[model samples]
Target: MTQNLGGILLIRMTSLGDIILTLPAIRAIRQHFPLHRVTMLTSLEYIDLVSEIPYLDEIITLDRRGKEPAETIRVVRQLRQKKFDLVIDLHGKFRTRLLSGLSGGRQRIGSRRDIYPPNTHAIDDHFQLLSTIGIQANDKSLEFYVTEANQCFAQELLNEKLLLGDQVKVGIFPGARWDYKCWPADRFAEVADRIGKQYNAAILLFGGPAEADLVSQVRDSMQADPILFDTNLQIGQLAALISFCDQFVSNDTGPTHIAVALGIPTIVLFGATNHLKFGPLDPMHTVIRHGNSLDRSKGNDMMRLITTDEVWKIAEGKLNSLDK
Candidate 1:
């Protein structure tokens, strides 16, 4: 690999959590080559997500659905014109592989899909890519910047919902992208009631517009009225709302990653997916996995194995410690 420190391109097109987790690797890359122009290629939805990241110099988006070889060839020509000194494909897919190969960079780095194993912790997998450029990720912290605009928007929403002051707020995200990853909505309501009684806390329910039904079910099940923010808040505004909570609970989902990045005391519930690869990175955050001997990779059985009391106990400990 050449140490020219010219223009560099990094490719990663994935969901929110994976993108957030990739920040530490990007940080390491920036530190290793401080003067190099760092550019990222991602989906159109995430082009704005990295706007506040000081390390990344530019972002290019490739918006395509399904197979489009003509569009792919056009994108390849566009990438080649950038004249990257180095290209790293964090996403080891066919399209990315083609782009990396055709980018005409002196140095190219990527995972050989044949040799790489599956389900490794995403951060560690990214570090593997960084090893090519002589950078090791010793500081594995996730990154986020809550802008002033985000704060103002969240403040206005809280004011409308009467969620002001130094009140003890407990936030809950009761839905995951897959129903199998979600815990029972009624169980979440029960836990909210228990914690609400313990601290007279304001329960804040959060999720995307698609999860409104789940959020409603959780609120309806609760004896206390949990405050539900509108489902229309942008991602940054949502992060601001999560930052306001004293403690947060969520099923394994994208916004949970945002809450974790904001350094909120987040408790993540694990079920079908293995938490070893996707759990909270902060040492203080709690992840409650079902203790039963069920095969975690197989089905939706693990969510049921976790009792509401167990979650309440963890929530109680975090809440009571705050009282001190």
Candidate 2:
């Protein structure tokens, strides 16, 4: 197959976790087409996060917030002007597929659910899409690049909070997009307390603006005072702050994927979602699912089934390994 020298445009818009999962495939694409201009089209909100990634030649953002229809047409026009040889839609949603079809690329590729089953891990699903173009992806590892400025910002924030030290730092993200996806706030507080007392670790609670109330609830419930980080941080800044942690604990949320990408030993609690499909595949991370079966109908009840002791045990093991 002859490789096209013309530009390549990749589309993946919205959701932090899904965007993060696409890194491995993007890296593979970059490796295969080193000379070709590789551009990524993602959501405007994730510009900071995507900018940190070193894989692509350029990044295009679409703000599909209030006026999605008008915004989509404007983006489609912009994409047409780019005159890409190949367009790959990493996000297989209706909007992304429409963008790929209308982007005026000579060749466009979208998700191949037939090649890779729905049960397959998201990272592998992305690789399956690349297979259609004869691009064999060997490295399935996720990557998240942290900038020096973000690192300095993280350090300064920690210093201000008196959290800069060699002491073990455990980052806890207690909020998820959906309530059913989140483990109980009190349970998280209990686990954080145990980790803090047992390891004398600094507990850092992280969340977005929307999760501020939930984060505060967890902090209030905790026996120990934790550093609150719900100040609407950009994704890159959040990644830098997470990098400072020795261990990360979270519900089935986007930041869990961020921690995994950063190679931080993470313990993620899963319920109502299939752990095999969405959970971290890295050996360094541990996934604690609610039960053997996935019953979304049960709602957050499934999340509640995962006891504090169950998660604490796994967290303790990972922290112990880190100590060694």
Candidate 1 stretches with Cα past 4 Å from truth are 65-74, 112-120, 291-297
lDDT value for candidate 2? Answer: 0.88
Predicted candidate 1 versus true structure: per-residue lDDT over 45-129, tens digit per residue: 6665677677899987777776477767777788888899888888888868878898887789985646545556778888887
- Model 2, span 1-324: residue lDDT tens: 357559999999978998998999999998898889999999998898888788888998999679778888898899999999999999888878888999999999898555667578988898878888889997988888999999999999899989758889999999888888888999999999999999999999998769989998998999999988855998888999999999999988899999999999999888888777788998889988757556667758888888999889998888888753
lDDT of each candidate versus the true structure = 0.83, 0.88
As for model 1, its CA RMSD to the true structure in angstroms is: 2.4
TM-scores of the models, in the given order? 0.92, 0.96
Q: How close is candidate 2 to the true structure, as a TM-score?
A: 0.96
What's the CA error at residue 239 for candidate 1, in Å?
1.0
lDDT for position 227 in model 2: 83
Question: Alpha carbon lDDT of residue 64, candidate 1?
Answer: 73
